[model samples]
Target: MKLQLLSDLHLETEAFEPEPAPGADLLVLAGDIDATWQGLERFAGWPVPVLFVPGNHEFDGRAVEHVVPALRGLCTRLGIRLLHRESWLFDAADGQRVRFLGAVRWSDFDVFGARERERSMRAAGYFMRLMASTQHGQPFDADAVRREGLACRAWLEAALAEPAAGRWQQTVVVTHFAPSLKSADPRFGRQPGTASFCNADDDLIPHTDVWLHGHLHCRHDYLVARAGRKPTRVLSQARGLVDKGEAEGLDPGKLIEL
Candidate 1:
């Protein structure tokens, strides 16, 4: 099936006009479409099935515990599929079946080790503070964020281990956070504060045929090879404005076929 992947639209800053390619079978909103839930309404009338995973921005100024259920209800009402620690099976006209596992995978802060984590805490502590103060007006501790990331990792590991995982001809893993270091902008990899949040651990690399992720606000495509597994294709399409000049020329609306 032809899948149109989009992410980091940040519609509040950059409006999104849904002009899917001809014969586009499905639309995947990887994450960060907008900060407000209402932004999703813009895509309601699209002709194809829509699937989404939440981005970190979706939780901005809102409690994740509350926002998640609300987003699920909104998706149900709008006929959109919200994939959170879940899987969906789609069958193509030609009888090929593909499975999509979706999650808003958070950074485990293990990308660069303890020194980077300390640096991130020192440099980006404001972000953690904002989340703690505003999340449901209850303290959303840093430990909680780390726990959530670990939980997502555990869920993915279990999901891939399931016998059902073997049935699909291909498995596409969708996440808001980059799963591999290669997907992250190389310049940011060693930065003090931003480096930790740019990637997730590479444990999921072996199980994915195609990894769709956002949050970098930059587009990338590369093949990642893991021990005893074939190379996995990783793709990201983000339309948000980036301060880095390297991402200035990327076409955010690019359509990718899987």
Candidate 2:
């Protein structure tokens, strides 16, 4: 299937909007299309089917408990599929079957190392809380993200472990926070703040056909896998912050064949 991916557009800025790639079978919005979640309305009558997974930005300025239900209502009304700890199956006209699993996959702050975890939690947590979101009527802090991220990781792992008794040809995992450090921009690889954007799930890379992520404001395409396993693609096409030059490499019209 030919698929197009777009994320981190941050349309709340109102400075940019993406042009859809012609002939694309589906469009995957990885996350952060807008902090207000209003930009999604623009795609209400999108030419092709759309799949979305919420990013951290989606919860900004709102109670975490309230965002999902509101998103569900909006997505339902707009005909967009909102994926949150869920899997969706798509059958290509030629009979190929692909399963997509999506979630926020907030970082556990374990991107560095075990020794630095405590420090990562303290640092990454501060960075995340800067979004000023609340959960269950309280600040949604790092510990909250870690709990959620760990659960999401486990859910994806379990889903991938399912037997292919049914006949799906491939699995695609999508999340706002990246699953592996290899997905992070090299220049900021070891930074504590960067740890908030990825997790230590590199081992999971080889288990899926393709992994797409957002949260970083740059574009990337790379291969990752287990020690002796076949490589899988880990890609990101995030149109990140405009002022910091992080959005420099995005190709608004790029598409990938799955």
In terms of TM-score, the best-performing candidate is 2
What do the candidate models score in CA lDDT, each in turn? 0.76, 0.85
Best by lDDT: 2
Candidate 1 structure quality by residue, lDDT tens digits, 1-258: 678888887776664565665667788999888887778887787788889999888887777788789999998888889998999998866577889999898766666777567565555556677544345456555555666777888999988777764577888899998887777665566665554356555766777788899888678888888778678889888766644443476664466677
User: Model 2: C-alpha RMSD to truth?
Assistant: 1.6
**Model 2, stretches more than 4 Å misplaced?**
226-230
In terms of lDDT, model 1 sits at 0.76
Error of 1 at 64 (Å): 1.5
Native-referenced Cα lDDT, model 2: 0.85
Error of 2 at 81 (Å): 0.6
User: Which segments of model 1 are wrong by more than 4 Å?
Assistant: 129-137, 227-229, 242-247
